[model samples]
Target: MKLKILLFAALCFLSATVIAQTKDSLKTELPQISLSPVPVEVFAGNNGVSFQLIVSKYFKPDSRLGFFNVTQFTGKYDTADQAKNELMSLALISFDIWKGFSLNTGAFIDNYGGFSPTAGIQYLFANKDFLIIALPRFDLARNYNFEAFGLAEYRPMFTKNWGFYIRGQAMYNRNIKQDFLERSYVNLRTGVTYQNFQFGLGYNYDVYGGTFNSNQHSFGVFLRAELF
Candidate 1:
């Protein structure tokens, strides 16, 4: 009986996915960019391509802030069709709060670019010698239609200055247009990083107006220079 019930539910889910596979103006209305921390390796081009740098500084043993930057994602195999095509960003941010907790935020602007938020406390843990970390962040951007999601992430190191991670991110917005545009867009992001820079690729599927379904495969990079 349980197996039958599970099968029925699976069938219904598939049907829903099919029904939602159309162009949604609301889903694609807003800019699909924001500041978040990802590793440098995942930002590779369609093939094996990418260029970036990463850096960080410890404000104290438990507090820190930093940034990720990149000029471009250029290669013969790049979709941009230029040797130096790097026009995507996700700035970088780092913070440590009370009791092994911290915050990370950034702005989604250009390749090799990333940013994480700077509000809230974290119950954090590290994997090895500061090479990897885990945390959850709650964010508020003070915009009704741009409410941010609470996220959980895993960052692991591959080299002394290289790393990667997979993050689950979500946000809720009441302003999602239901007629022909969906205002709220949630994403599941996974990518890698080296130094203070990284590249990410993601997928977006939602409904607000008419349903326009699409996937987001992106390459990113950034730089971090603290001046304080």
Candidate 2:
């Protein structure tokens, strides 16, 4: 029941985020989907969707990579606003290089849910007892004209599953044609976890370089569903 509620709330949050946006600013909204949404694009268009193939293989010590190409065919939808029978294609490549230090890179086409290529480096200290991941990330398409760039994640207990984390991020895309279109947010996340998951809330102050439509005291749960 709790899981179901969590899912409902997650969706509600995503929708609320979207509804809060002006018709013009509705592009930057996204649902809190499974960390891993198959690199695929679903669109409402006239063309039918198609698929592409992505391959992944091991490279360096404990490092591996994979890519996915997917296509959608003409289909129906539950929403009236959604396009009918349209084709869309997307590709994603996720790579991780690991040794004492680790690096991850990913890129995608036709951004639907902020799935784009970004680079980050992780450094471990004291026999990998302390760790930190520095990621400057961004999404694409009309959905995310506002690029989100930040450095997030720090594990003080590199070996144990408990520790603290600090994250600072900014969102900005100067191309949007709106008065309060240029915006940025700064927040902090901290907590402990048993594994790769972090349990806590974040507080952020977001603004469009002005005051109107700004957000303060934005809080939400934090989690990471990691595969290897």
lDDT tens readout by residue for model 2, 5-99: 35435644644454445334322321112133222212221222222121222333322343433343334334662443233333434332332
| lDDT at position 100, candidate 1 | 36
lDDT top scorer: 1
Off by over 4 Å in 1: 1-48, 51-56, 60-95, 103-123, 129-213, 216-228
Model 2 CA lDDT for position 219: 49
lDDT on C-alpha atoms for all candidate structures? 0.38, 0.36
Point to the candidate with the largest TM-score: 2
Reference-based TM-score of each model: 0.32, 0.36
- Superposed on all Cα atoms, model 1 deviates from the true structure by an RMSD in Å of 16.1
TM-score of model number 2: 0.36
Off by over 4 Å in 2: 1-148, 158-161, 176-181, 208-213, 220-224
Per-residue CA lDDT of candidate 1, range 1-228, in tens? 343335435644643453355224323332111233333332333433444332334433322343323232434464564633434433446443322333455543323212323232223333432332232222223221122333455667888887875655443323212222222334355667566544466543333322333333433332322122
The TM-score between candidate 1 and the true structure equals 0.32
